[model samples]
Target: MSRAASPDVARNARPYLYGGEEAAIASALSAGQYNHGAVTEEFEQRVAAFLGVPDVVAVASGTAALHVGLLAAGVGPGHEVLVPSFTFCATVQAIVATGARPRFIEVNSGTGCVEPAEVLAALTPHTRAVLPVLYGGRAVDLTPARPTLDTRGVTVVEDAAQAFGSCQGERRVGATGVVTCFSFGPVKNLTCGLGGAIVPRTPLEADTCRRLRSLGIVESAARRAETTTYTVDGFGMRVQMSPLNAAVGLVQLDHFAEAETRRRALWRAYATALDGIDGVALVDADVDRTVPPMCAVRVLDGRRDRVFGELRNRGIGVGVHYPANHTQPAFSPWHRPLPVTERLGREIMTLPFHQHLTPRDAEHAAGELRRALVKADR
Candidate 1:
């Protein structure tokens, strides 16, 4: 059906871009206070509560949250952080921003999460920590790697950017990691217009993250207002979340549960509708355990480019989740032969699966994909 023929279709055709700035503006205006105020605190508290963590500090971006988390975890120059090559560049950028090196590792093509075995194989004495990305909201099973890290005395910092509400087995992604980071960027499941949060597993780590997030200052806005003077004791960055962003986040939190439910439903609808198609393999959804933040599929038989081009021509906004981070020019120094990561980088594609997409939209996308494949074959 032509989109112009139906208002319902037109409404459903709207792009599922993450975050709504209008809601943020309205909330900011209604609250009156604009800087780091009650809204920011409320957003942090709500995020922490939702993740079942004791503390959550909102920051300017997910990359900022990762930088603060790594700094708090004591990652610095001369140290190495084992990271998956099959992730967004921000993961490596965060490591570099902390003056640490990101040692690239391979990922499993089936799940897109880091291969714990490859991580253990790549470990070195200088490896202080490992940052496993939860790709496409599929939780990286860190249970097996716990022993490896313990043996090496390395911390496990989870990059749960794409898996904010995802669960592994029984526990949520952020609640168990030593220092977990979540991105609320424009495309993330939960967005604050452009923000992120860090959930520390320990009190000391949480305190350190808080300190680092605000310019090495010990006092928060909440604390500063209660006292007369503020003291700057250590080095920190200006990574604190603004009240304006927090206001949007607070509103988003109010609908988080419902949003997640809708996202999952969309994921299922896409998977069910697209399963039998050639040239694409949908990642397995452990619906009973995992809550996928994005719907990812692998384009097979080297047809990725043609498929992507066709989707774009049809106004279906698809995405390549990542290019192998290790292959990026800036990160080439850490690059080794990562065959799986390289292959997946070429094949992986993300479809629109957000709260805004109706089941029919997903089906339409799937139908278009099928047509694209047929055309490519011809």
Candidate 2:
């Protein structure tokens, strides 16, 4: 199939790279440090500080971050990992990569996140972990289910790929979960061309994750630079972040506060203009706590596809955050009635989102969306 046409207002734009990123990349190139190096360490340290986590290990991609995190947490074959089917397929793929069986679960209709009740009901002796995604940068209150999870000895692997700067109460997602993963992909809130990070709560988990990011080698690239030889005592993969990507991440981190403010404002603009429209309504999320991953609205008139196409015709980009994962052929065996996930798969529509968009752009998108909804209704 031909590539989907880029819209005048992109659904999600590339990271806002500033002069600092250009310099960081240039410095890494001049130093001849292409693989993970001092720059990568600096980026990791900065992320650790931002998330208030003990330590973080940078990786090649968000998927890799999840895979290594599972391994570090000791999830293996015969183990089951509970995850919501409303999220991106990468969450399931990561579980399969570690030889763990993924058990699909329901999400709260309002938040599009897995609720504690659903998780509690799904917990079994084979369940080794629970991967709760912060849907659209909205925080999942794990507190309600923490007691059950703790009693069952289940690890909480937070998928904070879309929630790098978001928080619940005083604690950030990364700081509260057993291990949290963040994505710094091309279109994410914090873009690094391509990179991710694993925030481990303990020193041992951090070391394990660090080794897993590399080829299970005990020593990091920086350490091997000083000495020619390295050792590998555990299984691992070569998923380390490149210095170039790390440089971009560092710059993005530096400017995140300003970018976050702009992103939140744009999200609020959409919420103000789009909420309570005749045929569509914005999904529930805590704007005060979330960094606003995307502006997703639920079409109530069974016309999500029509609205999406109409918006595209008007040069406004739109997207479906995802289809229900359980319905996919690969995960068919795990398929069951996920009423909320299935409904959302058809109702949720993602509008043009990114820090690059302005309040005026948001209003325009909202107006166009309302027109599309009206047309779909007709």
Candidate 3:
């Protein structure tokens, strides 16, 4: 397939970076009260509505949302949380932040998600929660183990930072889990510049999350304005979402459907273009259920480093979704022999898949990748 007629896609420029949405954010800023107020509430309400959940509490970052959700779920010292080794460091950090031990489990090589069987095997009496990540925005079917967890009294907190509009079976990712955490960081599907949110199953859980976000305070200006006086009840962190970030988030939310459509199209383009390349294997994408947040492929036959180097030499920007978290120095003590995660971390390579890339750009990138693979083979 001669797919090389496109103009040069900028090696450094990502078509979907956030500067283009400044006007909407400026309009929200003009309303004053740039901290946490009506704008924040509106942002939260919109997120809650989008996820089909009852409540959403915005916080400073995705990590903070996970920490607060764990705390709100009553996870504390001596508790254990089952986490996937092949994920962003935030997953392990959240468990550690709650003063709980993270029982690292291996991921499924095919799906890049935590294996339910491995998670079940790791369950202990001290197990307080199981955090399954929606890696690359794919729907993770937890139905297979739900009954077992329920019987064992284990809570499921979904780490859905990469999956905002994803659906599993018939239920949205956030709606079915006891608590789900989302990130609005610069690179997430929804860019708030820097923020996160927690979706809880019930009103009480929602209220607790709200308190935890605001430094354990039971009341704030937003809450008091509805009543009379403000009150502080418990210790809290300054994890409240800023009006600035929320304003940006609201605009992002407004355009989310359109943005996701573009993203999905890009993913399909890459998948089609890269098919049958002997050295590269496209990561499994459940198009019907996932709105892929990143485009990744496995560089097979031990040529990962050579291909990665060649792409960089061609000025094509690539990324690694993560290294195996358990192998990192900070979390090494928790590391066990996770053969799949260790190997996948070495083989995985993330290609650019964002709202900005045109079909032609995708083709050109794939062409370059094909050339790189041929060179590596030689």
Candidate 4:
């Protein structure tokens, strides 16, 4: 594709649509099965099979996946969940949504992931769960901390919104035993326009998550249609993935291998280009095992703001992934000192990343960063 034909480097990220997506959406519309339908169920099954799991529960969005997963894990009021403060606020808000306090933990600066020691150290008498955010699509291995967590009865629910196609050890991310949640948002590795899924640990947990997403209705949609009465058992929310979005997801899943390959190649191209550049350090994604969502770097010497400004002025897209959430006004009541996250808030920068751009685009973006760094220092 020509530079003009493609979404140029000025775009930080956008959904990469393969052929037939429009036709799939049209077919779903023609069927007129907008809500819980055959299409959505098929999407769920395909996702479960791909991850080598028995079942996957579909939901409206990634946040919904976290909320439902937490609730299904028996997390509720009077509980404390250990979580990293370096991630997007949605992770923190999900804990708050469950009426649980988030005990903020720190992450390693190089990978932007919570270390095993951090999880082990943050534990308290009220701790009920450990929520690990898979930043930049890199898997966080809590193997060393699992024994203690299990002994304490603290469940691990991973926030894998950015880690859809990434791997952990021998199996893919969601296939791991822990309760994992994934987002199929527009710009994610897999796009459903707007959707998410939960990989439950047991068949029982799967049923609970399904019920939670469907407003605690005891009967399935088919079962309810044959009867005059439907039972609402407990507190739940209406957040099922729509058939329209599922149609898009099925098409995207068919072409997911291409996404994995291209994303890895683009990340490598950026790594090669940025090598030996002073005043910048690449945030390692363990690219051999990660399908990176973005190429992140730390700009040193308090130069990130100026470098970001320079790139934007030159029409090269640059972004900050997140600000520290613990210090936010809404979460201040639960705040604990996180010095590493505070420093990362000032240094982290993300370059333009998406499947639409080629390796040449990666080179161009890195070149622009090098030039901006020179300008910022002078």
Candidate 5:
């Protein structure tokens, strides 16, 4: 296949390097500081500065961030954490790992995110936390239920894995006084290769997160290096982000503004191309505030499967972001009827989206999607 027609649209998501990651990794390797070290600390500080937060705790993966953030917020056995059934399984798993039951909830099909009313209506006496997912790089606002949550002593720990660099109104997602967690995975808005960060609500919580990620060690890395003994104040996990990954993150952070611009432009292109298409409705991410991680559309008329297969055959990457977790065998114990989420599971389809793609690429993908939808209708 030629470059222009090489099925470049076959990729649903991919990591885009700014040509500095290789050198950064090389430098990190040469320093021989493979474990958590100065590079990791620098990355944490940089992210803290970017989010305008007092501190940010780095961890091994987005799942780790979720796990520790929940733990830090006092979620554990016999507790119920409100979560949407429409999110990636990892979100539910994190709740499970904290020994909490996931009280499955529904999302607004339009944006695939949980709403404050849905959360407010689902609360029970056991409700200890609300883990709102930032679906498709769109920030979820649960402010309407804030007073109730606070009065009831429930914490809001955000699963913002896909929303790095995205905003929540006037301020950024992490700056909204919530326990926001972000993933810098290979295909996220910001790639740290395989890393995540937690924006704690206070300096004390930040310290708690740091200790949690590093196996409850009371002493800092520098302090441990100088002392023969280290203290373990409580239960914890070995999930700290490695210096090597942090090195890559530092470089990615430097070019994040360009990433924001390119991703938004591409998402907008898809919106324009698919504007009047029949049998489909775009899942709006409020692009003005979101740095969209994917362009999702709802294939109406019970045609999502057909359209998906058609697009795949045409080499236009298409996928379902999630299958409703409530119906999944693993989560059946807490299963509740989420009719809206069930329908969303059947309809959601994501198109190719990545920094490597251009506006032209989005247009091409949208055109192919239209063709697929028409074929399904036939």
Candidate 6:
């Protein structure tokens, strides 16, 4: 392949903004409410309603959502959160922020989701929570682990950052007892520039998350606005979402169904084009109810890097969703050998997957990937 300039096909394109976003922003600006206000409340309500959860609290980032949600779920210092080491660093970061330690767990090879068997095996007296990620929006069959998690009194905090519109059976990701956290970053299915939300199962848990997101104030924002005096009742962080971001979130929510349709189409196109390609295999995911966040493939025969380089050379932007967190320097001390995670860490490669990608783009990327495999074999 020529190391030449080619028309760019973005690996992770900026989110497709809804037509109503600008108008929504204009309305918010006209109202002179840039702080976490009514618009933020509306966005939170919209999210809760969409997820079929009791309530939601929008926050600064997905990491913040994880931290506050865990705190609301009674995770704190001296507690251990069993998390998949194959996930983004944010998972462990949030666990640490809550003063809890993250005990790394291996992912199931088929789905890249945290293995329930591993969770059961890793439980300890200090195990306070089990943080399972919905890898690539694929469902982690939590039924098998629920009984054990309940018996041990461990909370299930779902990192559904990549699974905003995904579902397992008829239930949405956040609709269960799990305190699900979602990201609204630039690359997520729903974007608010940089924001996240926590869907709590109970109103009491929602109240706890709300207080923790704000500055632990006794008075709610509505109350603070009505009264002149307020008191700090508990510990909190300044993790509330700005009204501007909330406004964007509201508009995105309005058009999310349409956007999800495009994403699903692109995902299917990639799967169809690359299904039988040698040295490349698709990650297992339930696309029927999934929003198809990303189309990640595992490149085999020691050709992962070669394929990555070739794809880039052809102007097909690609990504490695993660390099195992357990091996990162920050978490190295806690590292234990995870055979499956280690194997997939070297093989997994994310192709250009976004709502903006066309069928032609998918075919071209797959063709280039096939060529790369042949060259690598030679």
Each prediction's Cα lDDT score? Answer: 0.81, 0.86, 0.83, 0.93, 0.92, 0.86
- Tell me which residue pairs clash in candidate 6: none
Model 3: per-residue lDDT, tens digit, 27-94? 76788877687888889999989888778999999999999999888899999999898888888999
Mind giving the per-residue lDDT tens digits that candidate 6 earns over 6-107? Answer: 344655455777688888888989988776789999998888889887688899989999999899999999999999999999999999888888899988
Error of 4 at 131 (Å): 0.5
RMSD of 1: 2.9
Candidate 3 error regions (>4 Å): 1-20, 223-230
**TM-score (C-alpha, index-matched) for candidate 4:** 0.98
Number of the candidate with higher lDDT, 1 or 4: 4
lDDT of 2 at 242: 91
- lDDT-wise, the better of 1 and 3 is 3
TM-score: the better of candidates 1 and 4: 4
Q: Residue 128 of model 2: what lDDT?
A: 97
**lDDT comparison, 3 vs 5, better candidate:** 5
Tens-digit lDDT track for model 5 on 1-378?
123533668988889999999999999999888878999999999999998888999999999999999999999999999999999999999999999999999899999999999999999999999999999889898889999999999999999999998998889999999999999999998998999999999989999999999889999988999999999999989999999999999999999999999999999999999999998999988899988899999999899999999999999878889899999999999999999999999999999998888888887888888888788878
Instruction: TM-score each candidate.
Output: 0.92, 0.95, 0.93, 0.98, 0.98, 0.96
Candidate 3 TM-score, C-alpha based: 0.93
Q: Lowest-lDDT window of 10 residues in candidate 2?
A: 1-10
Q: Model 4, stretches more than 4 Å misplaced? A: 1-7
List of clashing residue pairs for candidate 3: 215-236, 215-237, 216-236
Which parts of model 6 have CA positions greater than 4 angstroms off? Answer: 1-8
Candidate 5 regions off by >4 Å? 1-6
Q: Give candidate 3's root-mean-square deviation (CA, Å).
A: 2.3
